[model samples]
Target: MNKSLITNLVAALLLVAGVLLNNTLLSLVGLFALSGGLTNWLAIHMLFEKVPGLVGSGVIPAQFEAFKNAIKTLMMEQFFTQANIDRFVSGQDSQVHLHLQPVIEKVDLSPSFDKLVDVIMNSSFGSMLSMFGGASALTPLKEPFVLNMKQSLIELTQQESFIELLKNQIDQPNVMAEIRAKSKKLLMPG
Candidate 1:
């Protein structure tokens, strides 16, 4: 059985045996044990269960909502503060870099190549190009041009200089503050 039940049973038995044998010391000890056990049991019970005549029983259930709100407030104010978030982000190593090669590969540079062709056709070289196949002559260059452009962009972005520049931009006070604020808004929305 549970400790509370065992304690109460033992104490009650002690009290009955002591009284039947006319032993004052045993009786006193039994009375104290029984009173203490019952008192502790009642206290523990009162915390979780309401008693009709008790003023402040079942306090945990009664203030459950308040307790939840208090815990949320504590988490927000202490652990999820703006400074804490900023510190967490800032503490990361400078070597942390964003991998953009996959994104660059997915980019459609066809529009860019078309724009270039339009520029070339409208330029002073337009009349000379009309003598040949005109823009269609450049049409064959589209695939190669897009491929080369994407490769160049991927290389440029992967360069240490570009990574450093990007890191510096992100490390700017205004940028970091804005990032922290946005993260906070996302994490602790109303």
Candidate 2:
């Protein structure tokens, strides 16, 4: 049995015993206990059910749309605000640089070297290059090129214009609309 039901039952038994024994104090205590238990039970019930003639009952179902709007507002205004975005970007700067190392390591500079070789092969250096090892001579430069590119990218991200551009893109009206639409779809999920 529910705790409230057990409480009410005990309260009822106390009231009956008080009446039989003619004790006013016991009767009053019983009445208070009964009233408190019943009121708590009724309030809980009102949260889920529409009580007849009772205003604001079944509140969860009644205010579901408002709840969804509140969720969307909280997500967009509080969580995705400009200040929050700036904080996140600032925090990830070092992380971004670290992650770029693997990408730089994976880069293949052979194609670029081949193109350079083709250009040189067609120029005045063509005959002289034929004596040299051609594109294979550029293999030693790959590590330095990758390192320079990575450093350049890290420097680019540190610029104020780069952060400002990111903020502008996130703050765009279309982007906000798309976010709102996706949030609604996630919450409602038809």
Candidate 3:
């Protein structure tokens, strides 16, 4: 269940029980509990945004409802700002290549040659003739194969889907709620 929905459900049950008991003290306690849940609900709202002109001044109604806006701005400044991006771009990170190299440092083609030969033999006769032929076949094809492999690698490296995947993950609501719940638990009593 969503945190807000869980809180609302609990608050409603507490309020109903307090009313049924017909006791003033229990009703007062229920009101406090309801307020606590309402605070959590409101807090979740203000986390991503802020209420306008909610000041941090002396004798003000809510001296720090603006805390949420300040926190949001600080978060953006630290992690989502252009300056941070520029800092990353200017830092030593450009040299930090994290892509994994192929497990086999060199693919030894010698072991696979028999399969290639068999495949060639199974194909048309002209291809088989070309496969068993002299240096003429090997010499011309080697450079093209190397160039094609390098081009394929370069294209793969330039793809941006990995970055997009991380971007999407960071914005998922369930992910955010789990993080929020865990972080809240660290400081709050049950």
TM-score of 3: 0.30
Per-residue accuracy of model 3 over 1-190 as CA lDDT, tens digit each: 7866787777777777888988667777768888888887666555545566643223223534466556655665566455444334333446533342352224444434445545555668646577667334454555555556555655564467644454456446565556555544443426
> Which stretches of candidate 2 lie above 4 Å from their native place?
71-190
> For model 2, how does the per-residue alpha-carbon lDDT over 152-189 read when each residue is reduced to its tens digit?
76677567787667666755767666666675577557
How are the candidates ranked when ordered by TM-score, highest leading? Answer: 1, 2, 3
> Model 3 clash pairs?
none
Worst 10 residues of 1 by lDDT: 87-96
Superposed on all Cα atoms, the candidates' RMSDs to the truth, in angstroms, are: 10.4, 9.0, 15.6
**Candidate 1 lDDT for residue 13:** 86
Output the lDDT of residue 169, model 2.
76
lDDT of each structure? Answer: 0.84, 0.73, 0.56
Can you tell me which runs of candidate 1 are displaced by over 4 Å? 1-95
Deviation of model 2 at 142, angstroms:
34
If ranked by lDDT, best first, what sequence of candidates would result? 1, 2, 3
lDDT of candidate 3 at residue 77, scale 0 to 100 = 51
